[model samples]
Target chain A: MDETIRTILAEHGHLPVEVAKIGDEDDLYQAGMTSHASVNVMLALEDEFDVEFPEVMLRKSTFESVAAIRVALGELTGS
Target chain B: MSDAGLFRDELVAAGLLVLTGTDGIYGRSSVYEDIVAAVDGLAVGAALAEGAVSYRFPPVMPRQVFEQTGYLSSFPDLMGSVSTFTGNNADHRKLMDVAQAGGDWTALLQAAGANLCPAACHPLYPTLAGTLPEGGRRFDVAGWCYRHEPSVDPARMQAFRMHELVYVGDAAGATEHRDRWLQLGVDVLASLGLEVQTVVANDPFFGRVGRILADNQRAETLKFEIVTPISSAEHPTAIGSSNCHLDHFGEPFGIETADGGVAHSCCFGFGLDRITLALLRTHGMDPGDWPAAARDRLWA
Candidate 1:
C-alpha cells in the first residue's frame, strides 16, 4: 500500500522534492505541493485506488501526508 | 514577458487602463470606460428583458450584513474591512505625530460601520430577506467588488467591477435559471467574437478545510465558469460564471419562497474587465478594426 501510494504521488503529486525523501507524516504543502496539484493528486488517487473520496474525506488533512492518505483509504475500503 | 504579458502592457500603452504603480489597481480611460459601458449596458438590458429588477449597491456594505453572509468562515483571507480613526483630539494629534515621524498610524483606526463588498450579490441577499413576493424575486445588481488578491496579471485585480443577475425562488426554478443563463452567457460572449468554453469550476475557498467544500461544489456541479484564454491557453481565465447556491443564502437570511420555504438561489456574474481584455485579445487593441459582427453586437 505504501509503495502504491508513493507511486501515485510520484506520478501526480508535482512535488518539488523526491517521493522517496518524503516521510509518512511530512506535510505535502510545506514540501511545495500546491492546492491545484493536490486536486490532481486527489483525482489520480481516485483512479488508481478505484475508491471515490466522498465530500467528508475531501480535505487538505486527508492529503496532508502519506499516512493520512493511507488511513483515509483504509476507511474507504474498510481494510 | 510572454505574449499575454506584452498584451497587458499594450493595454496600458493604449490608455485603456491608467497605471497607478500598483499591480492590481488601475484607472480606466474614456475608451475603456466606453467599452465597459457598452458591455454593461447589454448585460443589464438582457437582465431587464428577463424580468430582473435592477439595484445598484455601494462599494461598501454594512459590516453586520457582511458578517451574516458567513464569508469570514470560508474566505477570511480575501475579506477587506473598512476602518476609520475615531479618536479624541489628543489621540488624533498623536496619530498625526506618528505619521509625521513615518510610523504606523493604522493602529489608531477602529473598524468602520462597513466593509468593502467582496461580491455584488452578497448584500443583495440580506436586503431581500422578507421582500420576496408571490413567485420569489430576481435582481439585477452591479457594483465595484474588492478582493485582496494582488497580481501583476491584468486579468486578475484586487478591485474589479461585476454585473450579476441573482434569482431567489424554488430549487427547480433556480436551477433552470442557472442553466438558461449558462448558455446565454456563452452566446453573449460568442456574439462578441470571443471563443469560450464552459467548465465545472469552484471558488478559491481558503484553508485546509476548504478543499472538501471545493470538491463538493464541483461534484455537485454547483458552479460553472465560461473561460477564455487571456493570459495563457493552459490556464484560461473565467470571464463569467453561473452558480447555484441551493438554500445557502436563504436559510441564513430568513428568505422564504412563495410557498413559505427557504428559497434556493443562483447568480450569474460577468467580469467586465476580463471580458474587455478578452475582446482586445481576440479582436485587437483598436475597437475600430474589430470584426463587423463583433462591433455590431457591442456598439450597434
Candidate 2:
C-alpha cells in the first residue's frame, strides 16, 4: 500500500523534488506542491484508488502528507 | 507564441498598455481608456435598467472599516494598506541618505489610516447597515480596486477597475438577483463575441485552513465566475463573478430587512480590464478587425 501510494504521488504530485526522497511523514506542500497541484493530486488519487473524497475529507490537512493520505485511504477502504 | 505572449505583444503594438518595467504597474493608452469606458457605460446602463442605485466610491477606505469587514482575516496577504512618509526633517535627511546609499528607504513611511479597496462592494455594506425599505436595496457601484498581487500576467494586475451590482435583501430575493445577473453576464459577453463559461468558483483564501473555507464555498455553490480565455484555454481567466454572501455581511453590519430579519446579500462583479483583454484575445488586435456583432454591441 505504501509503495502504491508513493507511486501515485510520483505520478500526480507535481512536486519539484523526487517523491522517492520524501518521507511518509513529510509535508508535500513544503516540497513545493501548490494548492492547485494538490487538487490535481487529489483527483488522480481518487481515480487510482476508485474512492471519492467526501466533503469532510476535502481539506489541506487530508493531503498534507503521505501519512495523512494513507490514514484517509485506510478509513475509506476500511483497511 | 503563447496566448499570454501574443496578448502582451498586441497590447504594446496597439498602445493599449504602457509598460513601466514593473510586472503589474502600467499606464493605459487612450484607446484602452475608451474601450474600458464603453464597457463600463454598457454595464452601468444594464444595472440602471434593473433599478440599481448608482454609487461611486474612492479607491481607499478607512482601515477601521477594512478590519471590520474581516478582509484581513481571510486575505491578509492580498490586502494593500496605504502608507505615508510621516517623518520629521531629520527622518527625511536619513531617508535621503538611505536612498542615496541604495538601501531600503521605505522604513521611514508609516501606515496611513486607510487601505486600498479590495472589493467595490465592501464599503457599501457598512453604509447600508441600519434598515431597508419594502423590497430591499440594489446598488450599481464602480471603483478602482487594489490587491498586493504583483504578477507578470496582464490579466492579473495589482490595480484594476471593477463594476459591481450589489443586492441586499431576503435570501430568496438575493439569490434570484444573483441568478439573473449570472445569465445576464453570459449573454452580454456572448453578444461581444467572446466564448464565455460559468462555473462554480471560490475566492483565494489564505493559508492551510483556508482550504476548508474554499471547499465549503464551492460545495455550497456560493460563487460562480464567467470565465474566458484571456491567458490560456487550459487556464481561462474569470472576467466576472457572482457571489451570494447569505447573511455573512448582514449579521455583522446589523442589516435588517423589512421583515426585521438579517438580510442576505449578493454581488455581481465585472473585471473591466480582463474583459477588454479577453476581447483582444478572442478577436485580434485591431478594433476594425473585430466581429461586426461585437463592434456593434459595444458601439450601440
Residue B35's lDDT in candidate 1: 80
Clashing pairs for predicted structure model 1, backbone only: none
Candidate 2 residue B61 C-alpha distance from true site, Å? 1.1
lDDT per residue as tens, model 2, B1-300: 666766676788788888888766789987777778878988899999989999999999999889888788679999999888988999999999999999988877899999999999998888997779878999999999999888768898888999999999999988998899999999988989889999999999886546656875776688999998887789999999999988778877889999899999999998999998898888877777888888888886
TM-score of candidate 1 to 2 decimals: 0.80
True contacts kept of each: 0.26, 0.26
lDDT tens per residue, model 1, B1-300: 876667779989888888898888999888887788889988998999989999999999999889888788779999899999988999999999999999999988899889999999998998777646776678999999999988778898889999998999988988998999999999999999999999999988876547766875786688999999997889999999999988778978999987788888999999998998899888888888999998898888
Q: Which residue pairs collide in model 2, if any?
A: none
The candidate maximizing lDDT is: 1
What tens-digit string does per-residue lDDT give for candidate 1 at A1-79? Answer: 8899999889888897999999999988788675556777887888888988887787767888999999999998898
What lDDT does the true structure give each of the candidates? 0.87, 0.86
Model 2, first chain, TM-score of: 0.93
